[model samples]
Target chain A: MSHSVDTWIMALLTLCVFSFLYRDNPFYRFAEHLFVGAAAGYLLAVQYQNVLVPNMIRPLGRGNLLPLVPLALGIMLLGRLAEKTSSASRWALAFYVGIYSGIAVPAYMQAQIFAQLADATKPWQPGWGAINSALILIGFLTVLAYFFFSAPHRGLHGASARVGIWFLMVAFGASFGYTVMARVSLLIARVQFLLRDWLGVLPGA
Target chain B: MDEALDVRWFDPNRINLLVGLSLFILFLFVNLRRARRAPSGLYIRTLPALQALDEAIGRATEMGRPVLYLPGLGDMSEVGTLAAVTISSRVARRVADMGCGLLVPCYDPVVAVLIDSATREAYTQAGRLDSYRSGTVQYVAAAQFAYVAAVTGLMLRERPAANVYMGSWYAESLFLAETGNETGAIQIAGCDQVTQLPFFVCSCDYTLLGEELYAASAYLGREPVQLATITAQDWAKILAAIVVVAAVVATFFGYTDIDKLLKTS
Candidate 1:
């Protein structure tokens, strides 16, 4: 088997993370802190290179004034560091939230609402497919009815919402199952690494 | 003038979308205006999970321990952040009145500031401004695992009696809840994440499902604008159901025009 500094470090970090299953300890804390510090440092460098230098500094350097609007907002955001000046952050927050809400309105309406409705309205094909289409329609309506709290869920609304709960449970069950499978897959990969790459207990290479 | 440089304000292919958007907005405005003039006594079915929030807070107050709210680990710009802070404000108000300690460990510095201000404002509004502590709303850690580690440690050491988890969560949902459970805390969690729902459902004493999280906020706030918007959303859903049923019938008899009408570029 071959060995390298990178490989050893990888094994050590992996083991450190895995050790949390048993109990939290100094080694785990060291790895966790190191990970956070590394991430923060990387984020700082990326922000400078990708955002600050390029978007803000260069545009101003090229004699464009529009970037100043965002630069000013960024500066105002930093005002949050001090209590006396923190109120200035509200202007930035308001602008950010207002813009986001405006953009999200049309975007959400188009994609989530209209597009979904359009798809739901697809022509029902015949045979067993027709039955499936009907079920989908029922499921969609019931689930939607479940979310519709403007009308009290009683009588028909109550019945439909109950049905919706069943559908939602099924959906959640499937999602939960999928997530479990994903975690299991990760466990398998880690175990395979420990055996094959680290210990060379299996055939390969 | 290059034809290639020509920019159209409205794309012809999405005329259907333009019409749909217009109608929806018009409907929302009409409902909003009507609601403003006279609240329709908006019927929101009782959610046990939301009710549990008060009970959980009360339990912490009774136990003489802090109530911890972990608003998931997302960027400050997301809708979840807004929801978190909104709920945090509500909780802070209640905490001030009850004289119970509140813990809000923020992931983003910007959000830390927002929530701190929000909590302070809530405390002031409750006329208990002196009780507000800035340390409760400070940033914990930025990295996901680091945040989880720090929170887990907090749960072990602080041993909050009631833990409220909300907003958009990831893999760390269970991590926090399991740790909170070890402390024998009464936990209530809410989120729109489908995958994390199961974990919350299993671990949390009461869990608010998807869409219900937003509904809970609107319910708690009961602000006119939010109520009207929620009413519009319900109407939209009803309209969608109608459309779905009609389209299914139309298609069963062989209709293609509806499909074409919805197509976009």
Candidate 2:
């Protein structure tokens, strides 16, 4: 076993989290609560030091009037604490939503829609690559048809949509398999830490 | 002067995007006016997950168990989070009308505030403001895994009958869904995150894939303007498909001008 106190604490906490797989128990609960509390507290501290201090407080302190706008919005967000002032919070929410939507609308259009369409339209390579390109175009068109909510799915549109559903399901299946592999890797890492770091029993250790 | 140093006020490369956006807004305005004039003519296909919202709340009410809602891991700036909150408002209104308990644990503090306000407003609209509990919405941990752990713990302890998850999700999607599944709750999950949809589809009773989550607000609200926006989006997609096919045909004929025009930088 490791002689270091920190290492022992880390191992025990790791085991406590792992204990959740068996069932919820006191050890797991203790670790969970500790993690939650520490995370929240750490987040508050970090936000205060890194975000509020640098972005808001320091700017305002330096006589920059620009930070006042966000400060006012932040204060308005706090209006939810009371019944009478709660409606004022909507303004802050509206401002936030408007800003984000304005920023995202053009970005999404450029990146997702136009850029993707441009790439898809590029000339196909020779031989087998042309077939692959054709398949991609078909998939893109079918999926687009499937997502066409304005039109009723009937006849040719319905057939294309059915093909689109198959494409979506196959994509989802591949993604699921890939993610499951990632999760298994995470588990292996935890096991490796237990054996190699804590007990010093692994080959490298 | 060098061409590189000739900085203009606007980027010519993004003209296509500007034109596209302008066309979309024109469609939106035209549709909105039309829908306002004749609201009854609009048709929207049924979304199974949205249709189940009432059933989920009813089940929770019948079982005398609270309904748990997680508004995702995103803050207010995310469109997914905004849509989730809008749907949550409708859910809250229904839960209030049915006299069932509602619990919303939030990842972002700002989102928690917004949800809390929205829920209260929903209660007011339902004429059940007296039944509204201040503790219905809460700020959980800001950290992702910590928030998941807390929610899973709540799921086990409360054993809520219905779990509604919406908004932008990450790895915690499976953790939350699987835990709710274990508790035998009827779970409804919706997210725009492509990678996380598979996990939700596997675990949840109903999953809203991609744009369905965005469309939930319009579907639930049934407002002319919102529905008009959906129609406008469909028109934009149709236009995009046409452009794609035309560009492909043009490139195949050795005419690369269309492809170059569409390129953004």
TM-score of chain B of each: 0.89, 0.94
Which regions of candidate 1 deviate over 4 angstroms?
A1-3, A203-205, B1-7, B38-40
The local lDDT score (0 to 100) that residue B216 gets in candidate 1 is 78
Q: What is the DockQ of candidate 2?
A: 0.67
**What are the models' TM-scores?**
0.91, 0.95
C-alpha lDDT of residue B128 in model 2: 97
**Number of the predicted model whose lDDT against the real structure is largest:** 2
Q: What lDDT would each prediction earn against the true structure? A: 0.81, 0.88
Top-TM-score candidate index? 2
lDDT of 2 at B23: 99
What digit string (tens of lDDT, one per residue) describes model 2 on residues B176-223?
A: 999999999999999988899999999999998888888888888889
Residue pairs that clash (backbone atoms under 3 angstroms), model 2 = none
Model 2 residue A172 CA deviation (Å) reads: 0.9
